[model samples]
Target: MLSAQHINKSFSGVQVLHDVHFSLLAGEVHALLGENGAGKSTLLKTLFGMYRPDSGTLSVAGTPVVLGSPKDAQAQGIAMIHQELALIPELSVAQNVLLGNEGRELLNYGRMQARVRPFLEQVGLNVHPATPVKRLTIAQQQMVEIARAVARQARIIIMDEPTSSLTTHEIGQLYRVVRDLTARGVGIIYVSHHFDEIEELADRVTVLRDGRYIGTVRQRDVTQDQLVTMMVGRELVAQTAPPERTPGAVRLDVRGLSSNVFREVSLQVRAGEVVTLAGLIGAGRTEVLRAIYGADPSTGGEVRLEGVLMSRRTPADMMGRGVGFIAEDRRHQGIVPDARVSVNMMLTSWAKGKVGVGERDMLRAVEPQIQQLGIRPANPHQIIRRLSGGNQQKVILGRWLSAGCDLLLIDEPTRGIDVASKADIYALIDDLARSGVAVLMVSSELPEVLRLSDRILVMREGRLAGELARADASEERILALATGVHTHAKDPAVA
Candidate 1:
């Protein structure tokens, strides 16, 4: 349906895209595969008219066209659903969906909901049309984005990391939506790090590395290893389970932790150990982390660090105690979009009264962590917001490292990250555990839980359902516990 040839884009004397080529066929889902900073986002923005390529030729249905702005692209039936959500928090779902489409007209709230409801249902989003966008979960907001695209009736749709935050069931729903759209002759550009997703949804896969087109192949014609090699230009080392180790003194202790979303829950993490919280979306796993980090209020609970009860537990108090939290909603809660990388990485340390350090000293200290984490652009002065999702996540990890956190609470650590970056993050987490940092993580990906966890704790609804040792855990067992099909006996360590 759409094609671009020899696309070259540059920003501020730095060339990002070099002779990139892409094409999409009517009724076909084309997958774009690339690591962070591989120019995938840049290419997508060019296609969507958010950026005009420095040199290229774009054609729609065999006719040459120049799209100057997003509105121009939308007029040409193109729509982009970004990984970072763009919905206004205070606006209702229907209002957000119909925002630009609704022309200068008279009042019609009832009509707006009626017009948007079908699109919502088509995308399997069940929330009321009048519900505020802020009330929806990340996954639901993603579906709303898809629904908005459908509402736009765009023949060419671009989805960036659409399933990053979705549950397994939600992913199935999205697959159905994609199939339906394709059945109607809509062309889609699917961007993801997941091989399984590409295998299921894509017809042709294109690989890009460092802003250059690597190659394109049929999905069924290429193995995952081959694709990895194409994207990173090397034999990607697989992440294996860490070597067995004995944990040391307990670093964190939560007893009778109660919140609006979760019941009394108790867990403990020892030094040099990784404990992962495994459960489906809305299983109260995130709530537990927030309560522990003091980001959200806990009605009844007590948190202790090294046998000392923490009477006043606020985010600042936790930071002072060498506790670090990596929030799941990175775009909203984790990053300072306007700040430079050095500033964002030093936020925790500064918050803990480390501001006495000179600016040059702080930048010097942050430089090593930046390199250690492989944060792209590798410049401490680069604006944190300009980096890709994976790189931004690395910066967050660097922040905790700079603060010298002994206890880390990480939620969905690799969400929206590419496979190569995921391996890097896994290695970093393993290194942290080996260095005697206690790590408690929440992950929706079962493979990640099995790969990293020394112990797995499952939550269902609002309570702890079961726990399993690393050797005893599997996707089936985790699902069983998460869905209440079966519950393992409580581990004495956690009890």
Candidate 2:
């Protein structure tokens, strides 16, 4: 349906895409594989007219096309759904679906709802047409986006990380929708970090590395190992399970923790111990972390640190008490985007009364951590916004490190980071624990839960369903606990 040849794009003297080539067919799902900064997003934006390529030729149905804006791409029957969805939260589902396509003259609510009904049904989005988009779940909202794309009669749809936040069941629903669209001859450009998703959904796959086109292969012909090698340009090492450690003095103790979302929850982390909270997206793991960090105060609970009951438990209070937190929403909650890396890195120190300290001293101190954490370009003055997703997360870790936190509450430290960055973060977590810092983490990735955690606590609905030692944990056991179920079959760990 669409193709680009010899594409080259750059920003601020930095070349982001170099001699890149990509193509999509009328009814094919093409998977784009890459690390965070491997030019995947740039390529998608180039196709969608968000960025005019420095040098490239694009064709639609064998006719050359120059797209100056997204409207031009839309005119050619091309549409893109960004990873971070752009739905208007306050608008109703039907309204969002027919936003621009609403009739020219008359404000016809009934007609619009009727028009959107078939598209919604096609995508299996069974929510009320009049329900506000904000009221829908992420997966439901995603289906609504698909419904809107189908309403627009887009021949090719670009989906970026569509299943990142979705549950397994939600992913199945999306696969069904994709099947329906493909049946109607719609081409899809699928971008994701998930190997399994690509293996299942993509017919052909293209790999990009360091802004250059690596190669393209049919899914059946190329193994996952080959894909990884091409995207990263190396034989990537696998992360092994963390080493065992003896639990030291209790650091964070939550007894009878009760919040609006969860109730009667109790957990503990010891000095030099790493305890991971594992569950589904809405299983209340993040909420539990928030309550412990005092970002969201629990309704009824007592949190003790080192056998001392706390009076005040706000974020400021927690920071003052040698506790640091990395929130779930990193962009909005964790880091200051506009600030320089040196300034952002020292935020925790400033919070802990580093007002009179010299800027040179601060920069000098963080330079080693920056080197240690592998923040790219080795420049401590780069704007946080300019860094890739992985580097941004490293800055968040740097902030906590500067604060000298005795106890850290981290949520999804590797949510959107790439594979290599994930390894760095995992190593840092182990280093922190070995340095006698208590770590309480919440992660949705099951492999992460099983790999880095010395102990795993599985939450379901709003309570702790089960706990497993590192020696006893398995993916099936963790998932069973997360879903509030148990089977008698022997897993290797249990066996």
Candidate 3:
């Protein structure tokens, strides 16, 4: 029902999309596959009226159209669910569902709930209409987002990484919802990092690379490896490496860690060792790391660094104790997007008295590190927001490494980043380990855990399910632990 012809878009003199042509038909789920910065999001935004394409023709159902604003797009039956969900935490499901264009004179609570009830049921959500959204899990919150779209009666829905943070079971539920939407003649634009999902949910796939269209193919005609080759224009390097260990004394220790979202969990990491925390989403993996780093409050836990006991404290206190934290949400929690590269690079150091007294000295301190980290467009004054997502993450990591923390607690080191940059990030982390730093990484990608970690720890339902040596952990083993599978047969190709 939606179509675009010869679309073109740019940002700050850089061409992000060029001669991009795309279309969607009723009841077809079209998968858009690409690396980060491939203009996938830009194309979606242009169609959704967030940006006016410099030159292109858009049509809906054979008639040319202009979507000058979000309202205009919505009026045209187009809806987009952003990668970052837009639900207001304090609002109830009913309130959020009826947010835009709430009915007449008085806002009718009973009518609002009644209006939302069927949509919730249609999406298979068991949430109460009156329940606050903040209390719901990520999967439930995502359902609320989908329900909102359904309530709007959108004909074309764009879902960006919809299953990135969802569990296997939750993904199945979402797939059913998508299938149901398609059955009712709705079209879907699916974007994701996982290619397997594309095979499962998509009718056709289009690949984009470096802001240009590579090609499109029928799902049944191509394999996953072929899709990757088209999207990247290269064979994916075999990413298997036997885990190495030269571990030393304990670097970080936690005893009886308790938080509002997590229970009394304890863990440890040693110097020169990479410990990975693996679990299904909402298994309290991120919470455990955050609590130890003092980003979130821990009700009852004694955190120790190098045998020194740390009391209940804040992030600053944790940093002062030789601990570093790389939060999962880099956009919101990690870096100042609008600031210059040098400023972001010096953020952690300036806080720790590493920046020099004079302006010249401080500039000197920032320049070398930025260059060493290979931050692209290496101009120190370049705004970080202008850089690619992977480059932004590198600057953030450069800031942390400059601060010289002995212990690093990182969350989702590769989420939403490109594959080439993922390799660089792995190298950086490996170098940190060679320097005798203890690294505790939490990732959802099974291959990453197998490739980079010296040891792996699995969590289930807010508890430590089990721990395995790198030699012993396989994708199957980690999956079994994460998904509650029991198997006696061991896979030799663990790495």
lDDT of 3 at 104: 59
lDDT string, candidate 2, 436-478, tens digits = 9999999989898888899999898999988898888889889
333: Cα error in model 2, Å: 1.8
Task: Give the C-alpha miss distance for residue 123 in model 2, angstroms.
Answer: 0.6
lDDT tens digits, residue span 62-119, model 1: 8889989999899888999998788998999988887798753216888888888889
| Stretches of model 2 off by over 4 angstroms after superposition | 355-366, 377-381, 490-495
Clashes of 1: 0
Q: Which pairs clash in the backbone of model 3?
A: none
Cα RMSD (Å) per model?
2.7, 2.4, 3.2
> Candidate 2 at residue 270, lDDT?
97
What is each predicted model's overall lDDT from 0 to 1?
Answer: 0.89, 0.87, 0.84
Over the stretch 186-269, how does candidate 3's per-residue lDDT look in tens digits? 999999877778888999888888778888889899988888788778888766664576989999988888888878788889
Judged by lDDT against the true structure, how good is candidate 2?
0.87
**What lDDT is reached at residue 257 by model 2?**
92
lDDT for 102 in candidate 3 is 68
Q: Give the TM-score of each candidate.
A: 0.94, 0.94, 0.90
> Of the candidates shown, which would achieve the greatest lDDT relative to the real structure?
1
